[model samples]
Each structure stands twice: as C-alpha cells, then as structure tokens.
Target: MPVDQETTARDGDTPDDLGSVQYAQTAVVPMDPAHLERHRVVAHQKAHPASWAFDVLRTQVLQKMDESGWRTLAVTSPSVESGKTVVAINLAISIAQQTNRTALLVDFDLRRPSVARSLGLNRPKSLNDFLDGHASLAEALVNPGIERFVVLPTNRPVNSASELLSSAKVGKLIKDLRERYSDRIVIFDLPPVLAADDVMSVLPRIDCVLMVVGSGVSTQTEVEEAMNRLSKANMLGVILNKDESPTQNAYY
Candidate 1:
C-alpha cells in the first residue's frame, strides 16, 4: 500500500487538534528532535538521509505483512548492540506516519527495555508495571508526539523474563493487542535471539519476526544460529545495520 495522503494533510495541524477527537483515549507525549538524535531514532527527522532507509523498510515490511495477513511483528537481533531497537523504533515511527494505519510499538525486551529511553519518555507506569499487575494496559500506553502511533514501554528489567514472556498473561496480552483493532499494527521489540531464551520464548506468540544484524559485529555462525532459532516463526526478513560502505551509509 502507498503512503496515505491524509498523513501529509494533517501534518500542519496542532497535536491537540489532531489527536483530540480520534486519539483522546491515548496519552500524548511530545518528543524532542535532539533527544531522538542522541538515540539514533531518525524516522521523524524526515530531512535526514537515514530517515529514507526506515521509510523504505516500512513500505516493504508492510507490503509483506499485508500479503501474509499478519498484524503483529517482533523485531529482534542475533546479539546485543545490533541496532535492533533503533530499527524497531524508526520502523514503527515510519509506519505511524502513514495515515491508514495505527502503529503500536511494545518494548518486550524485558531484561533490557530501552524503547522509552530511545524516545526520551520518562513514563512511570509502563509494560513492566502492567505485567507486574501494578498498572493497566491503558495506563501503560503513550503516544510520543506522532499521529497514529502509540507505545507500550517497559520502565526497567524484569526478573525471570523468559518465564514471564512465555506465560499465559503475555499470550493474552499479545492476543488483546492484535485483536483490539483491525487497522492497528503492533510491533514488539524483543531481546536478542542468541543472548537469551527470551526471544525464543516469545517468538511463537507473535505473527512475524524481523532480525537485525550489525555489520562485522555478528559472525556468520551467529547469524546462522539465530536464523535456525527463528525458523519456526514467519520470518519477515533480516536487516543489515551499521554498514559503512561508501555506497551504503548505515542501515540497509
């Protein structure tokens, strides 16, 4: 599907006026461009060259998801520091920028949740609190100054993350998030596939998976191993990140 024209039309409207009617139920949080730059989140920075990469990624991902009838996507990497979180954040932002669909990003990397930090959000109640029974899902949802975008961030690390991820509660949470709205695309930022069993535990619950690999950081063996682990799920594709070739800038 092509990018929606309504997104461009609504770009000039104030956040309050844009979100007041349709997204009144969502908590809106303003995002600072400088803060986003620090975290390498460039999707909202449309003028940046890096932003186009994410826009292209978003289009391709959405086309495959649409063809496969998939709604929930889990973004993970073979190991840490592979720019998977950055990819997840940017891809979600790009998706939300499209007017036809609402994008909901969930920080499911419970052991090292960083989605809130990447977006410069200091939310007290998040996915952590919701999973611990301290807060409701509604209380955990936040809109980070983007139309058609919502985030369910995790504030801190959780104990027994693997167990929690594989638990019935998480299953129900994923089901609810997916079924709540037909026009919504839910993206989950999962832990590294080779770092822990967290990704494996949650893989079966999501509709599709995307693997991000950093150039020169992950070995061929590691990538193969990660792919082996992800073979059971509907593999969306792998993202090659931090590529510094003369022709390619960073992510591909």
Candidate 2:
C-alpha cells in the first residue's frame, strides 16, 4: 500500500560489512555461470541483457516493502508455470546486489520445491531437514556464491503442505526469520493461489505477497477467483509473464 523511492540496480554494490561466504554459518555452494543464461535465472547482466525485468521488479517491490516496514514477501501465481519461482530467485539476487540490505529466498512451496534446482544447488541441506527436525535452521540455509544472498531450499516435496504451513513450528519459524535481522528481506516462493490452500494457510504469517499471472495460462475467471481469495492480503502488483517476446514482457 505504501512506497519508497526507487534505487539503482548496482549489481555488485553489496555492503562491505555484509561479510563473505567463507565466514558465514550457512553452507556456501557454487552456482553454474550458465544457469542465468540458460533461461532459468533472470539476474540482469551483460550476458542476458533482457533479464533487466527482474531488476525493475525488485526495485518496485522493495520500495513498497521498505515503506510499509515489511520484512517478508510471498511470491505466488494464479496457477502453475507462471514463473513465480524464477521471479522469486531473481528478485532475491537483485535485491542482494544493493548496498544496504541482504536477501534470503525461502522455498516455502513444500509441495513442489524448485529453488534449489533452479539455482543449480545440488541436493543441499534444506527446509525438508529443518521440518523433519533432522537439522537446524542454519544447516538448512545455503549461499549460492552471491555476496548477500542466502536460500532455504526444500530438497523434496512434503506431504500435507497446507497443514504443515499452518503448524506452530512454522509459525515460530516465520517469526524467527522476521526478527533475526534488521536489514534482511525474506522472500518465500509459494504455491499457486488457486491450486491449493497453502497460500492462504501461510499468507497471514507473511508481510505481503506478489502475484504472478502467466499470459494465456489462466482464464479470466481463474484470475478473478484467485484475486478474491487474496482480498485481505497486502497485495503488491501482479506480474504478466510467459510472453513470447522478451522485449514485451510486462512487469506491472
């Protein structure tokens, strides 16, 4: 509902005090340089010039979050294949590129987790471990060679995702993540709003949400239904994705 001033992308402007991965408690992993150029990642750069869409999206989304004092953001779609996960990853990377804040991308889509795969993180310890009580939160976190970027990836799909999202354990997890750091933006890559009750289950625990609607993927009725479901959410704008022409990709 509120907005802050826009800022430059400045891809490598992460703060000097943010510290390096070598000293971080989270496990540091290497992301293939080819992943971004492979079309899965959209971190705008010289190699993938058209990926600047994520930078603009990040600026706008972060502006609203900063103004509203929101620390967590949920990224979801009306239905499947709307590029929500990709958007989440790119936004996290784009935000981490800034000088003031750090970004943590969490794969909260327990049903069909893809953040690890999308980032080329091979079987890293993840949310599955944390949820099963086999690992601590720090053990589940992964740094994909990005200075201020961290990820809590889900290694596999979990049963009863909606119920899991509503549990007390998850509630405490969200609270801890929110209060852990003063200048961290935690982004959750969630399931489609219309596909399941997972979004509604966890929406209350999050600060705000960004909807991704794929072009020609969902009907007008479906979009309307999904929006009505989010009537109470702190709705950030919707993204028009899956356009055939990259230049015509719509961010608003």
Candidate 3:
C-alpha cells in the first residue's frame, strides 16, 4: 500500500516561491558539524575506560549497526532515568557523522519527552502532531546543530502513546520513512520496556533494538525479564552505561 499523494502533501500548502521558505535556523545553523564534533568527543569518553573510551565505543556501535543492515533502531532501557535518552541522542549524533548518511532521531517516549529538553530545543513539533495528521514530517523535523542529523522532538505529552504507536497509521508512517530515506538512519528513543508496552508495539516495525543499561543501576534480572517481554529475539541488543568507575554490563 502506498501513502496517498494527497496525504504526503498538505492541503493549501504550496511550494515556496524561489527561496521564500528559507529560514535562518536551517540556513545558518551548523548543527551537523558541531554535533558530530561534540558526540565524537563524548563517544570517545564513553567507549574507552580511559579518558576517551566513548569515541571508540561510538565507532564500534556504528560499525556493528552498519554491518547488520540496521537503519531503524529503537533505543530503550528497563526503566526510566537509565540514560537511554542520552545514549540515543548522542548515538544518533555520532552515526550521522558517517559520509553521505543522515540520522533522524525521533523521540517516541511520548509519556516523558526528555530528549527535547536535554537538547535544549523548546517546544518543538512532536511525533504526536505527525501521527495525528496535524503536521508533516518535514515540518516537525529540526536540524538542531548537526547537518546529517535531524530530530523529531516530542513536544506534547500524550495520554495513550502506546496505543498510537501500535496503530496501523504508525506502521505505515515508519515503512514510508524507511523507504524514503534508504540512505539515512532513523533512531527512535522509545519508552522503557518495563515501564510501558510502547516499545513492544513498535518492535516489529523497527530493524533492531539497543537496550541501554545504566551501570550500577540496572540489575541482571530486570534486563533478562525485559528481553523476555519483547516479541522478536534477534532485534534486541544491549549498550551498557558506564559509571565513574568504568564498570561495564551486557544485555540481550
């Protein structure tokens, strides 16, 4: 099934007459360049046990995800405040640095949209507007500070985010995005699996899942039980959140 042409383009929306749509943010903001440099430093710090392990970990993650034909991935954790949002945003920034590849970081944790706040973006258009036919995807996307990366921040808190995610409309939207941006990657910062069934709903729609586990915070039992709750087996993996002591953990 194809998304209707009428649906893709909004009614009464005419193409901007030769640069009329030009905006200062998209035109002047060097979001991509700055974001990559920041994330490169951050990844270095996270990946290595030394001062710059994050960079190495970032590279490893990119390589692994690339090798697996992964484009749409859900970043989740066992519970909230586990640094899942932090990892998702930084990982998306790191991945967007790849040559000729763009990354779309979507905030699907509709119940608590911390990605936008963490990034300092104020009340941006959200996944709700896009899913509810209130805004076009492009209109909802913000360039932020990265050229190859765009973010769809969830500005409004939804009452039933899980239901919306599981709807047929969401499946079709994600499918269209995957096909449209074959060269780009879509990273969703999903709600915690144990906290809600939102991630479970979108499990079948995404390419893979990256479980973010906070060091000293997430227990083995929680990780295992969360994995058992997911629908697909191979789609899941783990990214450990290191502590000041640099302790590491793993997930399925």
Candidate 4:
C-alpha cells in the first residue's frame, strides 16, 4: 500500500525527500551525523569510505533476497557483542539508499534492545509501547532523517520476550509489516540464537535469516550450534565482523 496521503515531512525530517512518503504519520527525528559517525553507522554517509563495504553487502543481500522472493529478513549472531545490530543498521541504510526501495529496521531483541541507542534515538513512543497496547505500529515508527528508511526501536527490555515473540500478536505484526507496503525491506534485528530462545521463537515467522559473527568473539561450538538451530531457516549468509585482518575496515 502507498503511504498515507496528506503525509508531509514533519519537523526535523530530512529535507532530502524522495518525492514520496514511506510513512505519513511516522515521527521524523533528525539523526545527528556526528553521533552516527561516533557509533560507526556510516552507510548513509556517501562521503565515508567505510560505506562502500556495506554497499557491496547490500547488493549481495538484495540479490539473494530478490532471487529467493523473500521479504522479511531476521539478523542475528552466535553470541552477544558480535556486532549483529551494527551490520543490520548499515545494511538497512544501504538498502534504503536504493531509489526503488524503502527499508524498515525493526528491533526485535526484546531482552536487550539497542537499536535506538545505536542510532542515537531518544523518543517517547517505541516498540515497547506498541507491544504494551499503548501505541499503534504507525506511532512507534521513526524516520531518523534518512529518506526511505524508518526504525521500529525498542526502548526497554521485556522479561517474557521468548513467549511474546512466539505469540499470535507478534506473528501478526511480522505478517502485517511484510505485506503492508511495496518495495519495502523489513529487517528484524533479533537476539542471538545462543543467547536465548527468542531467535528460534521468531525464526519461523520470518522469511529468511542472516547470521553475523565476530571473528574473535564467537566460539566454533557456538557458531556450529547456532547454524544447527537455523538449519531449517532460509539462510541469507553469514557476516564476518570485527576482524582486523582486513585492510582498514573489518566488518562485512
């Protein structure tokens, strides 16, 4: 469906509109370029050389997804501090840069949600509110001054994340997001497969899964187990991150 009509860019929205609105009522909060830089989120920064890496990954991901006819992508890792969230964010930014695509990055790591902090977002309403029945999905979305990109961030942790993720409501949420809009890639940043049962709980609802593994952070056993758990999923390839072996940039 097309974005709601009469949706004008709100205050703090990026002036670089695509001559279209992806989210009519979504809050458009300008992201601080410096803060983004500090957090190593640079895919949207054309001048930053580091962005090229994400662009390449973006191309490969898009190609695979298009070929497989997949719509929802779940990104996770073997363990914590594997930089899965960072990869997901940059990939979303790169995808959003495409003239024909819009990107929706959803923070589904309910136990330790960090997409908002990683993106320098501090707002009132978020995924927590939506799950708690206090806010609508549209009200929980935020455009971080990046045209064609919106974020559904979770501001707090939920103790019953695994149960909630597998519930009918969460399934409906994923289905709605996947089928609602045209040319929109919905990326869900999920908890690690080894971290909890959360990833497995939500895996079946997602179309495909991407694993991000930090070179020195994840153990062979952990990686193997995670892959085993995801053996039934439509694998979207694994990302090797945080390895300094590569020249200058270490993330894929």
- Pick the TM-score winner: 4
TM-scores, one per candidate: 0.87, 0.87, 0.76, 0.88
Q: RMSD in angstroms, candidate 2? A: 8.2
lDDT of each: 0.82, 0.79, 0.66, 0.83
Q: Rank the candidates by lDDT, best first.
A: 4, 1, 2, 3
- Writing each residue's lDDT as its tens digit, candidate 4 over 65-174 gives 99988889999999998888888999999998865688999999999998999899998989899778887666788888878888999999999999999988788778
**Model 1 segments beyond 4 Å from truth?**
1-24, 244-252
Higher-scoring candidate on lDDT, 1 or 4: 4
Cα deviation of 159, candidate 3, in Å: 1.6
Across residues 1-252, which tens digit of lDDT does each residue of candidate 1 receive? 112212221334453331212333567788998998888888887888778888888989999999988999999999888888988998999998954798999999999999999899998789888778786666678888788888989999987999999998889788867765678899999999998899989888899999999888899999999999998999989888856321132433
Tens-digit lDDT track of model 2 for 1-252? 111211222345343211211224666786887875465675735356655777778789988988999999999999998888878888888888854787889999999998888888875468888778786666677777777888889999988999999998888788867765778899999999998999999999999999988889988999999999999999988988867444345777
Q: Is candidate 2 or candidate 4 better by TM-score?
A: 4
Per-residue lDDT over 122-208 for candidate 3, one digit per residue giving the tens place of the 0 to 100 score: 644566676777765655667665557677789888889889999887787677556555577788889998988788887788888
Higher-scoring candidate on TM-score, 3 or 4: 4
Best by lDDT: 4
Provide C-alpha RMSD values for all models, in order: 7.5, 8.2, 7.1, 6.5
Clashes of 1: 0
Candidate ordering by TM-score (highest first): 4, 1, 2, 3
